[model samples]
Target: MLSTLQPLLGLGVILGLAWLASERRRAVSLRLVLAGLALQIGLALLLLKLPFAQAVFLSMTDLVLAVQRATQAGTELVFGFLGGGAAPFETRYPQNSFVLAFQALPLILVMSALSALLFYWRVLPLLVHGFAWLLRRTMGTGGALGLGAAANVFVGMTEAPLLIRPYLAGLSRSALFALMTCGMATVAGTVMVLYAGILSDTVPNAMGHILTASLISAPAALMIAGVLVPEHPDAADRAIVAIPSTSRSSMDAITRGTLDAIPLWLNILAMLIVMVALVSLVNQMLGLLPTVAGEPLTAQRLLGWVMAPVAWLIGIPWSEAQVAGSLMGIKTILNELIAYLELAGTASAELSERSRLIMTYALCGFANLGSLGIMIGGLGAMAPERRDEIVALGLKSILAGTMATLSTGAVVALIL
Candidate 1:
């Protein structure tokens, strides 16, 4: 019974944390908060527990796999053996031959191009509108805020705001916070397949879980944002916004998408190199310190100590909390890509299946410092007059975003 009740405890704690961070505590709508939590729980049960929903998401994994294969085709043609092509020389350790930059990272390019093509064809807009409608009806979000939140599920944070570009200047503090929180709390579709590929060996139906995490986190984000910056009763905006496609044609969409992905691809590649090197350097410097429990005091260990309680609060078992916490810390401090890579590197024995599942949801967000800068820069460009306000709310959104993903983990823990 104690074990069964732990998740409920965690869920309450997660909600309480958001409540504590609320800017106007008295103004928070009990109805909206409860509705958002119910929606999150309901969606989790529908997507994760129902057999038909499971089958649908499982089927979607095949498309992810297909994209991987197609990406490999392009990579192989461009990079030859470096990109998973037939090598002239035999390697003593075949398992170590997979080059992440050449093989796995290319999936981002493929996914971006495919998403662009779908958007141009109006396929993605239909899905976005459906989700927007659901948010509008259930959460009482305005048209622009709901659409921006929904778009974040399919596109990057900066790109999501573009869908509601005209209304950025006029959005209320609460609505703007909701948009930023949703974007940071959820992962974009462009890198979803790449993440699935990385975790395929570790998590069952990896693509499905990643997709579901993003979907569920949307409501969680809005919920937390509403709490952090409660909308004034008289200030609510309920106008319905139209979804616009910027692509002129299918081919143009693909080309633009591919071009858009180049900078992101480079950014990811550079981040991996720099972050890994910096961590190694820090660890080497810390090696001079006295060992803790006969273990070297390194960055991961430090992070683990800091975030262990948070991991446990999300229903990760104590035994595995340190490792899980370290991943959470890496994700928050560095980025989710690094966190996922670290998770992939960890052995199964170190983290139980349940702990891994919880972490998958917990770590599936763009709430790191790097992304905060990107959000400010992108949104700032759109509304220069409100740049100061954007900056002020930016830091708080990180906390709100982190709480959003953690709340999803808590709900998953409750039902799993």
Candidate 2:
């Protein structure tokens, strides 16, 4: 019974923290909060439990695998043997690092261009609008904020704001918080494929999990954002906003998206190199410290110690809590991509299947320090007047987003 109740306990603890930190405790809506929690619980059950739903969602993994194959074809043609695949004179099993850089990362470019085409075709906007409409009706979020939040499921944090650019200035504090939290709480669809590729073998229904994470995180973010900063009366507008797509034609959309991805692709490569190198250097320096537990104290162990409770709080088994916590810590300090890579590197026998599932949910967001900088820069550019408010709320939004993901983990624990 105690074990069965842990998830409920975890949910209570997370909500308590949000409530304590709320700007106006009296303004938090219990009805909407319960509604959001119900939505998360229902989604988890449908996507992971029901046979038909599971099959439908899990099929996404095959689709992503198909995308990977397509990406491989392009990479093989351009880079030849070094780009992976069964090309002549190349090793059949290439190094993952090489494949990740040359083969997998290129998928981002493909996905971006594809996303633009979808937008140009009006499919993306229609889908985003449906989700946004649901949020507005259920949660009473303003149209602009709901659209932006829902758009994060498909686009990057920076680019999602473009969907509601005209209303950025007029958004209420709570709505703004929800917008930022949603952005930080979920990643773009472009990178989702990349991360899914890394963990495909390790986690069953990997792409399904990624999709569910983003989908469920939308409400979880709004719930947390509402608690942290309640919506103001002036900010509650029922006017629906149109989804804006920036392209003249299908060809133009593809061209623009490919160009847009250039900087993002480069940034990912640079951050991977720089951050990985820096972490290695830091570990090396820490390795110089006196030995503890008969082995040298390293960054991983330290992070594990720092975040172990969080791992446990999110329903990871105590036996595997530290390892799980270390992943969360890495995600918080660095980024989810690095954390997922480390997870993918872990021997299957070391972390139990349940723990791996919990960690996957926990580490699904883009709430690290690196992302905070990106959010500030991107959102700041869109609304220069509110740059200071954006800066002030940056750190808090990260915490809110983290809580949002953790809440998802807790819900997963309850049902899974």
Best by TM-score: 2
**lDDT of each residue in 1-416, candidate 1, tens digit only:** 65457667877887787788788899888878988899899989999987688567556556555666788899999999999899989888886887977986676576667777876786665555565566657886666788778767766686667555556787888998889999899987757887898999999988888888988899899999998899986555633344456889889988977786676566656645655567568879999999989998877668768888888887888888888888878887678988998888863459988888888999999987767766776677667788899889987888888888988988888888
**Residue runs of model 1 more than 4 Å from their true location after superposition:** 54-136, 238-303
Candidate 2 C-alpha lDDT tens digits along 232-347: 75666633445567688999989987787676566656645665577678878989999988988767668668878877877877888778887887887778998999888873
lDDT value, residue 222 of candidate 1: 91
Report lDDT (CA) for all predictions: 0.79, 0.77
**Alpha carbon lDDT at 75, candidate 1:** 92
Could you tell me which 10 consecutive residues in candidate 2 have the lowest summed lDDT?
90-99
